[model samples]
Target: MSEEPGPVPAAAEPTGDGLVQVAYLHPHQVSHSWHESVMRLVMYDQLHDARIVGTAGPLMISCGSGSLVESRNLAVSRWLDETPYEWLWFVDTDMGFDPDTVDRLVHAADPATRPVVGALCFAARETHHDGMGGRRITAVPTLYRPAHDPQGNVGFTTLFDYPENTLLQVAGTGAACLLIHRSAAEKIRAEHGDVWFDRVRYGDGRWVSEDLSFCWRLGALGLPVFVHTGVKTTHHKQVWLSEADYPRPGGGEAAHGR
Candidate 1:
């Protein structure tokens, strides 16, 4: 990867009529909780649009089908090739979020600078410390910061001590609730030729996820990735996980599980 920042394209201004279009992109399948959360978000978006665009309606939704990577790539292609929306918001079917999640992320983003913004989400399953460090279920955040492994290979590690209720720049984050600008997408497409989301095999023989891959590309292009900690989200696995469940070392609270 180039240490020098790739040239950032100018961000697109809102339409002459003061309209800012946003497309809601999702993968196949939907849970009841997620559906309800999205409905609330859409309702909020409708009101926002009415004030901004002089009309009110649901956001343009595009759902992709297939495997995770495939679905994401398909959604990206559709958003770039088929839609006229200025923003693409990726929301997972298992995610629970506030109605203002979209507004928070959009307000935090500056496409010319911070083009990719994501809301904080916890890992669905709790993890235990390696070795005989004791068996305590620790809740982990999806945010990541760049670091080198013991083997001297560059990679991203989970950000455990991030500040809450603030917008913080990060190396990457989960795609559960991410917002992308059209300019960022165009720059990425010009550089990588449509290979937006794909798993990468690192020098250490470890595979990084598609979301991290996309984030790395954005960083290479001089676009910063930000996480709005105030916009907390839930990741549903066998159980629901939220910010309250995040690990707080020495905070006296019990671990997530026994």
Candidate 2:
């Protein structure tokens, strides 16, 4: 016998213009900080003009042993197929950003120009000095430049020289907090199949992260990927600190490490 589907919840019912669909990489358990961030998102969605249709939960493959990267990719692709949203705003559960982060990112993402825009989030790593004695800042898997190996194959080099308080073109970046247009998502899925995110091995024999791999795909399609340096998000760790609150190398504000 065929089973009947359950009634739709009022919260899940369509509201507003259905222009954006927000999703996050949530695990079974989350921290207090993450809870606070989720609350902020909820409040922002209510007050914002761009109608966010829904916020989907995490995709669990097993009992807390699934690849979060692949899970997020699949979840987002499904949203693209099932929802009528024009944009997908992906935020990591542990990330902390301003309530206006989504507004700013969406404004910057002009469909005619920028199709993929990501916020700058610092990685949890030790700070070190570069060869020129300057402080080497580490971002979330941002590419420095393109490289060629002995076999004449090309690869990307990760870099830390990111601009502050401005938008800049990037070869690839992390997806801790990113806003992707529907056009770009559909294009990638049509050409690359459903596996939009995957680890790619470059000529240098190093594996590119999933986020970077997605960015590379966008770049290949002639879509410009940009980082809104002004929209910095906090990556939750043992000690919670955002890029805005973090101190710089010489006792100055860590505004995008500038």
Candidate 3:
């Protein structure tokens, strides 16, 4: 079976509608829920007055049994070299999102400033003891900020404190539902090679994910990463979860992400 096939571009001509062109890239396997989401997204695009450009094209699927990093890098490379799209949207196969996700993410992107914008994704942490000493699995945000390890090695820590329904600047975020401007990828390629996604080991022996590694590289190039908290997404683990599943810092239901 052949892997890493480039996506076939759509034949539509530019409508001069001013919508930013985007390449929808999926580097992982898909689920039935994700397919329904994509169909709804297509309908949303067709019905919306201002549609996302270049979405008429088929999804750029970079399938491989290698590393996730390899698949992601291949997809981004194809988006850069094969297509004229201005943005690359990385959507994981297990994610559940609203129909308007593309519209919100594209509009949130500022190619010169906020070149990378991620939707809110939550992941389950290992079972930890609650205040009452009962062990429980907690949901945590994938967003992060710069921090130092015990040995003073630079790394990232989960950003627990953030405002809801706002664009919060982040050091790194999971690639499940991420938007990357073409210019940002170009800048990174200019400095480093075309390897946009990589897993790096910190001096403290902590391993960083490919997505976070990409974010760090972007940060090095003066590109900022932001997460629009209003754009929520469900991550499928044993069960599908969202930001609403997150346990507040002090354990309250009054506010989200507090």
Candidate 4:
């Protein structure tokens, strides 16, 4: 990946008559550090003419014993039903972005082209198998592009060498920081009911992540998901780290520092 920032396309100024209502939804826990990161973005980021709603403190209803998925689902459902917001921006507490992150994401989600846009963020996963007798760990970019096998089965993997500063169609992505249109949310609710985010079992009998499950539901309605690579975000795991600290896909360690 290039060390320099990618070129950002100019976004049109929002007219008074074209204001968009947006709810900044944060699914948080008891981490003060992450909470502060969320506050900084909410306080400083430019979100076009969006009227931001929601807060960084206890935004989700408690589901007892750290039910992250259920909490997020309840919060999103309430926002869709009670608020007139045209968009829902889900920013996990552990995620940080530039001041123009929201603006860039909104620009990418042009109603005429893209309805759902996710920012590029880092994520880590661990898998265990009795045959291996140990856990295998993998860390990579969560933004993904879809692919198919010769047998016609769909699959997803990180775009390790994707072109810079472009909008790429994705099968799904981690909702750590994503911009979603109300129209898509409404469609899912009307067809699948209020259970918006959760682990869903696919035909292969494997449980999909909550983020992918939501994307799959939207895909069923012909809505496409995209990742705006121009708008990069930092996943604040363990301690604060920038994009440079992220482990590359193939093999390499990023410089680690404060």
TM agreement with the true structure for every prediction: 0.75, 0.73, 0.77, 0.71
lDDT of 1 by residue, 213-234 (tens): 8888888888888787888988
- Where is model 3 more than 4 Å wrong at Cα? 1-29, 49-56, 62-66, 128-136, 239-258
Model 4, residue 198: C-alpha shift (Å): 3.0
Q: Evaluate all candidate structures by whole-model CA lDDT and list the values in order.
A: 0.71, 0.66, 0.74, 0.65
Off by over 4 Å in 2: 1-18, 53-63, 126-144, 149-153, 238-258
Error of 1 at 210 (Å): 1.1
Over all chains combined, what TM-score does candidate 2 have? 0.73
Between prediction 3 and prediction 4, the one with superior TM-score is: 3
* Model 4: residues with Cα > 4 Å off, grouped in runs: 1-33, 45-50, 53-58, 63-66, 126-138, 147-153, 239-258
Model 3 Cα lDDT, one tens digit per residue, 1-258: 111212222223322333444444454567777788878887888888345533446446656565678778887887778766666778888788999997787666676766788999998786655555444567899978888877788888898866777777888999888988788889999999988888778887767888999998988888888888888988777633445556766875646332
* Deviation in Å, model 2, residue 246 alpha carbon: 14
TM-score-based ranking: 3, 1, 2, 4
lDDT of 4 by residue, 1-258 (tens): 112333444453332222233333443353465567656555654343334523223234544555767776877787666665556677776666776677678776755346788888788665443243544445688866566656666655566766577777777888888887777777888898876787786555667778888887877788888788878877655433335346776776654666
Q: lDDT winner among the candidates?
A: 3
lDDT of 1 at 61: 44
